[model samples]
Structure formats: C-alpha cells, structure tokens
Target: MATKNNVVAFQYPRLTKENYDKWSLIMKTVLGAQGFWENVEKGYTEHDVAVMLNQSQKEASQNERKKDKNALMVIHQGLDDDMFKKVANATSSKQAWDTLQKFFEGVSRVKKVRLQNLRGEFKKLEMLDKKSISDYFGRVLNIVNQMKRLGESMQDCRVVEKILHSVNSDFNHVVVVIEELNKDLESMTIDELSGSLQAHEQ
Candidate 1:
C-alpha cells in the first residue's frame, strides 16, 4: 500500500474539453511551485514584469531555461493529443499555457452557474428522521464536495451553520445549546459538532 503523505500535493487534473477550471487551477499551482508560473503568467519575451524571465530571456541562465522546459514538460504530461496539438506550435511555455487559457475562457461562467445550483441544493438538504448524525453529514458533504470541486471557497463555519439549522427536530435542543455556548462557530469543526451531537443522541 502507498504510505500516507503528510503534505498532500494538489491533484493535477488533466486538461479535458469540459473541465478547464479544475485543470487550470491545479496545473497553475503545480507550475507555481516550480517558479515557472511567472514565465507563464508573464511571457519570457515580454518583460513588463521581469520577476521570472527578463528581456526575451537574454538574462536567463541555462538553469532558468531548464526550469522553463521542466514546466513545459509537466503541462504536456497533463494533456491529451487533441489538447497538445493546440499548444504544439508554442515555442515558450507561456505561449502554450496562453493557448489553452483562450480555449477555455468560456468555462468560467458555466462553473459559476453550476456552483449556484449546488448552493440551492445544499440549502434544501436536511437531516431526515431516524438518520444518524454521521449519515446526515454524509449527505451534506456530498453537495459540499461538489461545490469545492468547482472552486467554491466554502468555509467550515458555513457548513457547520447549515448542519445545525437543517438537523431534525430530535436534535433541536442540542443544536440550540451548541449555538448558544459555542458563539465562535467558525472555529467549530464538523467532527467536533458531530461528536457532540452523537454523544447527545446516545
């Protein structure tokens, strides 16, 4: 079995015809870690921002150039033939990155609309009669996870508040007491809330 990782890497999502948001967000982080994000964000030849590469990269040492190649290689690894073909003509890593950006510019709006729908679904979710706290949380997290996948910046406080508000009447007293005593809802985690609620149930 694979050993557990303490520092989990951001998953490198593959460039797909329909998933530009996920792919670009993760790929940008991976590239950023290697110091090539600057070149990609601001081209090598274009030096308005000369933080990474300067003046057509005339100032770039061989080591910096190699880093650029490594960044390009990683981008290629995450692409399929069709996607790669679009960036094939790009000489610099930035050129390749920009080509894909232009291709997926329309996806940003679609992601927002999908996230709006998820918000509605989450608000409508509730704990049903006879459902364990664990089970109810599972339902809540399903929608939460989907929103997160679409780049929603969901906070723990919001999730905790939603759970407390939507719990069955069986948990009404406990939810009231929890909200009253734990005024700092932002600091309360789902695990802490669930454990408290489950203890009350038992």
Candidate 2:
C-alpha cells in the first residue's frame, strides 16, 4: 500500500549516461537502508505450493514478495522512460537490477575496449612543457580516476612511477633524487611525490 513517494521520502535522481554511477550508488544505499537491497541483488524465491508452510514461514514469504515489489517500484520511479524499458520485462527486482547494470554499466565487450583505450592514454600521458605541476598532476589524476571507474586495477606505485617518468626534463634532477632517496618506490604515495615535484617546480 506504500506509494513510491511514501516508501522513499527523498527524491531520487533519474539515471542518465553521465549520472549512472552516482545514481546507482545513491539508490543502492537508500534501498539497502530500507532492507530491500537483498531483493534487488538476490531476489525473493517463492515457496513451493506442494510443500505446506508453517504460518510464520508463509508470512515471511509474503513479506519478502512485498519487499520485492516495493524495490522494483523504487527502481521504476527513478528511471526515465527509455531507461525503464531496459528492465520493464524483468520478473523480479534482481532481474531488473542486472538488466540495468548490463545496459548502463557498459557490457563486458565495451568495458574491455574502454579499458584498453584508457591504458593507452595513461601510457601516453606526459607532463607537457610550460604546464604547471598542478595542471600536469590533474591531467594524470583524471586519467587514473577514469581507469578506476571502469574497473581497471591501478596501484599507487604504478601511478607514482608513471608520473615520475612522464615529467619533462626540467624535473630530471629532482626525479633522480627521489628515485635514489626512496629505495622502495612502492612506499611512496602520489601525494608525497607530487609535493616533492611541486617544491622543485617552485
């Protein structure tokens, strides 16, 4: 009997190409807090009519089904027509959730291709001449973050090494000093490396 507005007090943003990640996170958090996230993730299984269920079991099953319907309604209310159609045929909240992920989370094929392209960009990233240290770091961090969002595994050490190698020759002396001083490059954080580079640049 709970309406979508009554089930969720706050307005949940509709999912879009640019907002899918943020929207998905917020929706999951809200649903989880309401004890409906399991229905979305794993779905509710109907009890077999052939087996006689105790009164408590029957009541629990009915409650689970209600929760499933509510979860589906929450998802439906948050999507635009185009997005809604993606999961309109789903029989359960789990099916609807998986369908949405397939469409918006970039299917395996698309994600793989994107990951490759991002890796290439990361490899080609260099601190250009005349670019400030902060600007250069920002460029690198942008690529790193994009890679992370796409599920690529980027270690801090890998990023530190990449930045150290990519900076212009103006930073050659400092880079060498850092390499010598820090025998274990893996222990150096990006921020620490950036601070050292910024100091040299100034």
Q: How much is 80 displaced in model 1, in angstroms?
A: 6.9
Cα deviation at 16, candidate 1, in Å, is 9.0
Backbone clash count for every predicted candidate, in the order shown = 0, 0
Q: Kindly provide the TM-score of model 1 when superposed on the true structure, using C-alpha atoms.
A: 0.55
Tens-digit per-residue lDDT, 1-202, candidate 2: 2358568557777888657778889899989988999899887777789989899988988999999999988888889998888888987888888888878656656877988999999999999999999999999999899899878888999999999999999999999999999999999999999999999989
Error of 1 at 44 (Å): 21
**Candidate 1, lDDT over the whole model:** 0.84
What lDDT does each candidate get? 0.84, 0.89
